[model samples]
Target: MDKQIYDEMIENLYWAFPLLKTKLVKPFDKEEKEKENDLTGTHMTILFMVKEKGSICISEIGKHLGICKANLTPLVQKLIDKSYIERFVDDKDRRYTFIKLTSVGEDFLDNKRYKVQEFLKQKVSDLSEADLMTLSASVAGLREILMKIK
Candidate 1:
């Protein structure tokens, strides 16, 4: 493939990420939130990542999200304050700290995920099995490509 074509593909993919996330994911997440303390999409993403990874250092989280420690610190602190995450100094290394989702965090993720799953289930119920398989494969391919990029 030509370099220009690859560049355009990358650009388009970058732009489409936010659109797809907002259109498909955000509505369900926002639906159950209280008006005063609604979580932003970025916060929910960080929470989800931490929950999935079990425990991770701030540096690793920053690297994965293409953010800096200075930027991530406040967000992590906010989650800590909300009791969704806990930070602790590593036993082996005093200088290093790890962040993990608390039980509350896990509950939040499960509830929000249930909402998203229900939405998807209803939307995809009428899709042909072959079409569903195709989408699953395509998403796996996309994840592989993204992993390589990282």
Candidate 2:
């Protein structure tokens, strides 16, 4: 890629990130209080991470989240206490421990995702048909381009 095109892409990405965060991410976190669990973003992130990996060892999760195991223990424990996740020793090794989301946890995440989708739908409901089409295509293109990175 030409340096000029690269620079423009970097700048566009920088601006795009905050726009998406404020429009999508922040609202989800804000609406979380509706459930009364009062879970923080970190808690939700860990839930999502476990969901993505199916099951993940505690130490690996800590490394991915850049949190120390000492501190991650309580967060994991909180999830366990809420029955949102379960911890078990790896049967073969008896050394590595892993956590996985429970059915309740999956339900909770699904509900939250539905709400966020509804919220975004409401926010865009008044857009002109042409603008909505444009936005949809833009997002599709953005995803296609970004997926090439890895």
Q: Where does model 1 exceed 4 Å of error?
A: 1-19, 29-37
Candidate 2 structure quality by residue, lDDT tens digits, 44-137 = 8899999999999999989988999999999999999989999999999988999999999999889878987898898889999999999999
| Best lDDT among the predictions, by candidate number | 2
TM-score winner among the candidates? 2
Instruction: Report the C-alpha displacement of residue 8, candidate 1, in angstroms.
Output: 9.4
- How big is the positional error of residue 48 in model 1, measured in Å on the Cα after superposition? 2.2
Query: For every candidate structure, what is the RMSD over all alpha carbons to the true structure, in angstroms?
Result: 3.2, 2.1
- Candidate 2 ranges with C-alpha deviation above 4 Å: 34-37, 144-150
lDDT of 1 at 30: 62
Q: How big is the positional error of residue 49 in model 2, measured in Å on the Cα after superposition?
A: 1.8
The alpha-carbon deviation from the true structure for residue 95 of candidate 2, after best TM-score superposition, in angstroms, is: 1.3
**Residue pairs with backbone atoms closer than 3 Å in model 1 (clashes):** none
TM-score, per-candidate, Cα-based? 0.74, 0.85
lDDT of 1 by residue, 52-101 (tens): 88998888888888988889898889899989999999999889889999
